[model samples]
Target chain A: MIIYGSERVEDLSLRCDVVVVGSGAGGAAAARVLAAAGAKVVILEEGGYHTSFDFKQREREMLPMLYRDRATQRTRDRLVNVLQGRCVGGSTVVNMADCARVPRAVLEHWQRDFAVEIDTADFEAASERAEAALGVAEIAADQLNANNRKLLAGAEQLGWRRSRFHHNRTECTGCGFCLMGCAFDAKRSALVTLVPAALADGATLVSNARVERVVVRGGRAVGVQGVLTEEHGDRPAARVRLEVAADVVLLACGAVHTPLLLQASEIASASGQIGRNLSLQPQLPVLAVFSERMVSFRGIPQSAYCDEHLVFDPRVGMTGFAIEGIAGGPVQTAGLVGASGRDHKRWMARFAHTGSCLVLVPDQPAGSVAADETGRTRIDYALQPDVEQRIRDGARAAARLYLAAGAEVVVPALRPLTEIRNEADLARLDDVAVNPDATTLLSAHPQGTCRMGEDARRAVVDSRGRFHGLEGLWIADASVFPTSASTHTMIPIMAFADLAARSIAQARAARTI
Target chain B: MIPEIDRRTFLRGATGAGALLVFGGALPLGACVLAQASDPPPDLAVLSPRAWATLACFADHAIPRGGAFEAGASDVGVAGLVDGWLVGADSRLVTDLRRGLALLEWGPLLLGFAARPLTALPPESAGAYLASLTTSRLGFVRQLHAALSELCLLAFYSTRSAWRAIGYDGPIVLGLAESVELERR
Candidate 1:
């Protein structure tokens, strides 16, 4: 049963076998599996409950509704955005639904560096199950929009190895509104699939209930307590104190928020890594204006990716990056073009002819997230040198691709090369810096904040997703990733979440907790 | 001193460092807006007419009157849209914006003109002034330019006026996917 916590007359004090905080890719998957395993479960989501029908393709209308802080949650310097969903489905509602498995290299990094025990084959098996559950499949050749086609053609012409991405949707109508909360419910996010399935199996869900702190006693978690506010409004008329006690408290809040909650609860990691090692998948969109109408917004937003330039060699402290097709409605597009008034107006004047590709640079864990005394999530993140270098390389490649794709003018993320019309202009990209003032930057993926590993000293949780030295306290989200995935994070997060649930369920069957 | 506007903290892309916090953080929104917090707006609807006109003149120059575009920022009520967005914004931020505009009004005084409202300036003068602020070595002027530029661009394009200017036909409406597929068929 789904209940709006604020509507209740009295304080809410509930008991359950398991209580999962957050309902994104990780939490929803765990909620479904744990509840199916016959554990009476309750899920508390900080954001409101909204199904597919609730989505409006309008950026202004939808951003403030579905995203945390209206998709404006920025780091300390306000250069990088820690974008994630805050609703019942979490970021799965707002993301582009790119389902990438944990690559072999990333997994090996975890195994070798963090002592993560999962072998490649078992991880792949888990990934297959996750994909099956998520309805992950490749886009048909017919679904390729003009924008994606141009991007693909450019990569092929350059002899770059590009591949089509697998998305969770069964049939996409190509409205290009995935970022605005999938209006058609076609994007089978956790909201439409696992969350609903979990609700059907007798799991109770209370929305707009923010978990303040893990109620701990003698170094073990007992319950969680926080206030419930109005769903549609920021200011609560009368806040209701909502509390839930359970055998397991699984925090699946994303990297930006999970650590904030942990810090608020005084659950400091032994290694002092509670809010450290934040991984931001720094993404910058490089736009190209074509002579013909591409109308990039008519189809799936991101379907093709080019890893030809994504070079990662951990031994030498270099993780490469890739570029993918990106679509933006008016508001988002205006922001991506840069800070110039004339340049912005000029670009939008020919908007229909614009095709854009986003460069995804895999940044290492060089940031942190914490909650201050006011219970507000505070993030301090800055990209390191290697990540910046990768972006420079990627931007140059992106400019060439656009030029190759018959673009009349290419707008690389670099400020000076605002309008690159030819291959000669591409060389100017080398001087481009990764500073936000120099480029229009964004980040869709936030990982490794509350990283998992075996040693309690170096990580927040054990490999079983159990918080180190804290019984019945676990985390199932991207917060548990030991390293950056270097790709879209939905599937890997789901697979790991499912694996964590299986481990927890098996342990519970043996009365382990 | 930064007055920390975490609640509904909206940063514009064109206005500041691409990702630098103009509020609380390592860079505490220019070491506290206290330095410029002298004159404050009087109403809950904070912008005064002079302030409104200042943005108006600046907006016109930002987009300028030209090209294939049917409407500019002023026609699209961009200044008003931005005003509405700043309704509940932190007073310090609004004050900073107000000071930024006021400086431009009198900034020409630095260039040997009497202190007059920015709205009184010609389009060429206003455009030159804005560009001067953008290229200014002063951190204060650069930050103000960043905020104003982002706000104008975002608010302008966000309006229905800039939709056709950019080839965006507005919201795709229902059955957008199905209709596209059917059209293909």
Candidate 2:
């Protein structure tokens, strides 16, 4: 049964075998598995219940309706804008639908550095299950839009390594509104896939219910208490109180909110890592103006990626950078122009002729997430010296790629390097100071806040996703990643959550036996 | 965008500007200019009258009229739209935004760039002052410029009236004749 918290008149109390504290990629995936195993699961989603019909394909309406903090959540320094979904399926409902597994090198690095051991065959099986569930497949050659084709042609001309990405979209209409939300239900996000499957298996979903804190009894999580909110325009007004008692509590509130929830609940880990080790994987947008009309807003937003600069090391895991084709609506694109007055208008005037890509750089776990004195979530992340250099290199490479592909002018999203028409202009990048407020950076994948490993002294959760020092508590989100999972985190997160849920089910079955 | 100016440049030039502001006692100049009579929109939901005027002035300069597009941010009432949007935003963010707007308003006089507040300056001077903020040596000042500029640009470009100038065909789904409607939850 699905319950809209706004419609409830009085306080609600429920008892269940398992209570999933989020409805995102991990929570939905775990709920499906637990429900299929005959566990009475209750999923509490802080955001509203929205489906394809709610998607208006307009940023003005959809951004506030679908995203957390109206798509304006930023780091403490206000440098990188951290975009995450707060609606029914979390970020899965609004992501680009790119599906990638945790790179083998990254997994090995985790095993070596974080003492995390996973059965390769089991993980592969879980990944296959996740792929099958989401209908993951390679993008066809014909599906490459003009914006993406530019990246491909540039890489081919430069003899660089580039490849098409796999996506979870089926019957996509090329609406170019993937960042907002798929209105046609083309993307098989957790909203349409596991969320519905879990519901079909008798898992109850409560929407517009914000889980405030976990109720612990005798060192074990017994339940969660929160408030029901009703939508008043774009704001959610607090209303009735909600409480759910459960034998097991699974937190899947992404990396940012999960740690905040733990802090609010007064849950501490032996490793002192409850809200540490945050990896943002920040990306910079680079736009190019082509002479011909690219009409980038009409087709698929992201389809191809160039990993010529991407590197993986046995000692440090994923490093270097990646350049992927990207495009957005006018509102989002204009924000990246980094110009004022006439210069800004001149750039926006060529919106139809612009092709863009994001320079994604993998960084070490150097950031942290904590609540401030005002109880507001604070994400502290600053680009390290190496990461900053990688971003500059990636930006220059992306500019050259666009120039090689017949762009008239390449515009890095930074104020200092506004226009790069030739190799000479690229020299200007060498002297650019890459600090906060100098450019626009975004983070769609935030991981490693409550990282998982074997040793209780260094990890917040065990490899099986159980809390190290607590009973009946588990984490199934990107928060459990010991390092950056991959360029995209959907498939890896789902695979990990699937394994964690199976372990929980096995335990439940053994106890009953 | 303006050329990049790092902190060293600002620090190198700060002595002169600091002396002019400190010894010249130019801080009250902005207050005197702001004290002049002005009318503000009555239907504003969140921003104060002074903040609304400051934001309106900043938006006009950030996206002035008679440029690539005939309709600028002020023409589309971008500041009013922002005020309405801020109604639903976090209190901390709203407070920060108001402070940023206040800084922009009093920046020219306090920084010794002009004798008048931003709202009292001519359009070209206001535009130049706002552009200077983008290249300011102070990180927070540059951030203020970026935050306000982005907010204005977002609000302006999202309007349907600005679509033709940008060569965008708005949302394709809205134009479809027979759109498939999903079952509403």
Q: Pick by DockQ: which candidate is best?
A: 2
* Tens digits of lDDT, candidate 1, A1-513: 988875776788999988999999999999998988888889999888887777867665576678776665667565676677878899999998888887787788787889677767877887898888888889877888898899899999899999888899976888888998887888989998998888888899998888888899867887898888776643234477888988888999888888888878888778788888888888878989999999998899898888897665765222777989988887777766653555566677778888999988887888888765544567777778877887878888888887888999888655554678998877777667776456546878899888888888888898768888888899998988887887888998888888888888887899987
Runs of candidate 1 exceeding 4 Å displacement: A233-238, A314-318, A372-376, B1-58, B86-125, B138-141, B174-185
Positional deviation of A151 in candidate 2, in angstroms?
0.4
Candidate 2 chain A lowest-lDDT run of ten: A229-238
User: Across residues A124-195, which tens digit of lDDT does each residue of candidate 2 receive?
Assistant: 899999999999999998998999999999999899999999999999999899988899999999999999
How many steric clashes between backbone atoms does each model show? 13, 0
Interface RMSD of 2: 5.7
TM-score of each prediction = 0.88, 0.92
Model 2 error, position A250 (Å): 0.2
Shares of reference contacts reproduced by the candidates, in order, are 0.38, 0.60
Please report, in order, the local distance difference test score of every candidate based on alpha carbons. Answer: 0.75, 0.84
Clashes of 1: 13
Docking class of 2: acceptable
